[model samples]
Target: MKSDVLFTSHATAKNGREGHVKSDDGLIDLDLTMPNSDSDKKGSNPEQLFAAAYSACYDGALNLVASKEKKKIDSTTTADISFLKDSEDNGFKIAATLHIEISGVGQEEAEDLAQKAHQACPYSKATRGNIDVTLNPKAV
Candidate 1:
């Protein structure tokens, strides 16, 4: 169960949901806040950060899969993450819906690529059994 490590990232957060977070390289320094619909908070939340990372990671995986298959494609992926109540554990949980669009491909082909990418993506692998993720692929 051991693998080679290519790279590692470092970051730290303080004061829970309403504080500050910064990366070691200062590329991701930002304020943190709880997701609120009524309050005008000028900060980011964990769910948004996860969505951004997952979308980019998934897109990269999709490209890698396509290159392995000898196909080139233009793609855009949007990860919609939702923080929901975990009734069983009385805690919070997250779900994701990835909207994947691939140019120069049919619906079936796009879906196939997305499915393969999901299986290959690191984020997808990490969240496979821990969270629910839905993939919606479209040809554009």
Candidate 2:
């Protein structure tokens, strides 16, 4: 059951964690670095980039679900990605908390929509059972 590829993005990174990354489209060109409490170097990290991608994707999925349900929704989704210690592998792992706020909807409906969006979101499907993902949906 292989589906045709709809889109592909190309990006290259140099020097691992303390280098630069650039996309083929030249939209994302940034210096990369590890998270540090003391260093004030201006750079972006992998976690931040992943969070941004996930948040945008999840929001789009939510909108799609709402449209299919014949509901108009104004929503804002925030993905809080955390880099945590992996006890099993002695490495780092990531977890996510997605907070979604939808205007002009009831709390229960918002929560239901968020759940459906999670099912449809590609990121959520990719990270399912592999990471800890919490969904917090609210009507605002």
Query: Residue-wise lDDT of candidate 1 within 40-83, one digit each (tens)?
Result: 77899999999999999999999999999988799999999999
List ranges where model 1 is wrong by over 4 Å: 37-39
- Candidate 2 clash figure, as a count: 0
Question: TM-score for each prediction?
Answer: 0.96, 0.96
lDDT string, candidate 2, 13-126, tens digits: 999778899999999999988887466777998889999999999999999999999999999999999999999989999999999999978999999999999999999999
Model 2 poorest 10 in a row by lDDT: 33-42
Error of 2 at 10 (Å): 0.7
The TM-score, computed over Cα atoms with residue i paired to residue i, of candidate 1 is 0.96
Candidate 1 backbone collisions, by pair: none
The alpha-carbon deviation from the true structure for residue 122 of candidate 1, after best TM-score superposition, in angstroms, is 0.3
